[model samples]
Target: MLKTILSISGKPGLFRLVSHGKNMLIVESLTDKKRVPAYAKDKVISLGDIAIYTNETEVPLHEVLTSVKNKENGAKITVPSNTNELRTYFAEVLPDFDRERVYPSDIKKLLTWYNILIGADITDFTPEEEPATEETTAETETNAEEKTE
Candidate 1:
């Protein structure tokens, strides 16, 4: 699910991946649903591909967002612009996050993105549900044929 959501550097807001072109990506802004073409030159990073540095290791962005969501009771967060406040909130959300590797700006960006995601009701970061297997499809077809017969 997160794979379809992209964060293009130099862009103001989050964008949803609509399709891929030869040398560009077709993305729709999550905030206003505006469709735009992002060129290969743009630094486009999928939320699924992003992770934060933790004291123990790296933690996926989705996991960190989930932690924030649980902390906020799935409510929209008002991201703090102040560095110290942002750091305090992030600490509550993720205590073991590496302060050195993860800067204040990074925390602010995460907060803003996470809030946008929550506001858009994109909280669930679970993997996409798989399609039915061929065997299952065949069984269903056979059952339908038997009923018709």
Candidate 2:
């Protein structure tokens, strides 16, 4: 899922979260499989935390990516360089995408990211489910006991 994928500022490509140490995170490049340490000073963002502006509300990156995948049929797309063409292409993918808020560069970035993800063979754009905590487990047991009683 996108949770473990990272985009470090000033970095060229996406990275996978490998591990973390004090004041730094060890990230592996999705493109080259190179491991590098990202310091606290670096602005690192998880793709899962990204959202695109829409007419009504913001849409999560995963949903946008899924839309792109559906549009492209799970294949890499040729990113349109022309601004108007790019906008038109993006409109086809996300019809309700905010016209005023979403810039052409943003659309281009989204398309480029989609291509990168596809190249990496990461077709699944669904968010990863959070594991159940101990509290939730106990609550489930208590509910089961009550049902039995």
Candidate 1 per-residue lDDT over residues 29-92, each given as its tens digit? 9999999999999999999899999999999898898899899899988888888998899999
lDDT of 2 at 125: 87
Q: How accurate is candidate 2 locally (lDDT)?
A: 0.93
Clashing pairs in 2: none
Per-model lDDT: 0.91, 0.93
Q: Tell me, by TM-score, which candidate is best.
A: 2
